[model samples]
Target: MRVKMRSKHRKAVKFYSTCFGFREPYKVLIDGTFVHHLITQRLLPADEALRDLLSASRVLGS
Candidate 1:
């Protein structure tokens, strides 16, 4: 299941990059709701989590 999800994420990133010119070191918007959910789910080190989810070289939050 995890592997499948990761593959899907990679595919999505590739598609976005190819068709939309989205570059690496992606910028992410972190809102209160997202922060709350992360805390509730105990997903610490938010930056790393976002980086992995986006297959980004680095994650820049706004």
Candidate 2:
């Protein structure tokens, strides 16, 4: 994880995998990739809300 995430953008991607979420124990997932895709597609309203959360926390760019 450290090797792959050496930059800010990459580190931000890692947050999706580590951050709290609605996880399905029965349905396996590939961590960050799945959630990242959904965010890019804007399929979830929480996507923008979450970015705003990060911005407020000064974690990511607005």
Candidate 3:
């Protein structure tokens, strides 16, 4: 429900949530708190790969 981040780390944190694999139906928690519910059609390797891709893009700026 709430996302807490320091002022200097705001933009980067937002990108990690929205742009990365943490956005509606896969829920990721922070310190036992809910953040978002990112979803996928299936729970196969492909879907896992998608998450990995998103993470890579954030680091590589793809």
Candidate 4:
């Protein structure tokens, strides 16, 4: 699944930058911290992360 980001968030910029294939640099200051945004070729299934978290929670009964 393709996730289109309409607006840039510093948190996301930092996160996405950490991923491989994402090297284009961008910046945002979040909570007084400077965050760098990088280009990324990685496309994650939007629901995959949530699904895993939910499944893990169910398994652990948390």
- Candidate with the greatest lDDT versus the true structure: 1
In order of listing, the candidates' clash counts read: 0, 0, 5, 3
| Residue lDDT tens for model 4, 8-62 | 3434545665774444322222331211211132223423333332222222112
Q: In model 1, which residue pairs have backbone atoms overlapping below 3 Å? A: none
lDDT of 2 by residue, 1-62 (tens): 13433355445645654695522221222358757866796757643444442333322322
What digit string (tens of lDDT, one per residue) describes model 1 on residues 1-62? Answer: 28999999999999999999999778778889999988998888899878888877798766
lDDT of 4 at 46: 24
Model 1 Cα displacement at 29 (Å)?
A: 0.9
Task: Mark the 10 consecutive residues where model 1 has the least summed lDDT.
Answer: 53-62
Task: Evaluate model 1: give its lDDT.
Answer: 0.86
TM-score of 1: 0.81
Alpha carbon lDDT of each predicted model: 0.86, 0.45, 0.39, 0.32
TM-score ranking from best candidate downward: 1, 2, 3, 4
lDDT ranking from best candidate downward: 1, 2, 3, 4
Estimate the overall C-alpha local distance difference test score of candidate 4: 0.32
Question: What count of clashes does model 3 give?
Answer: 5
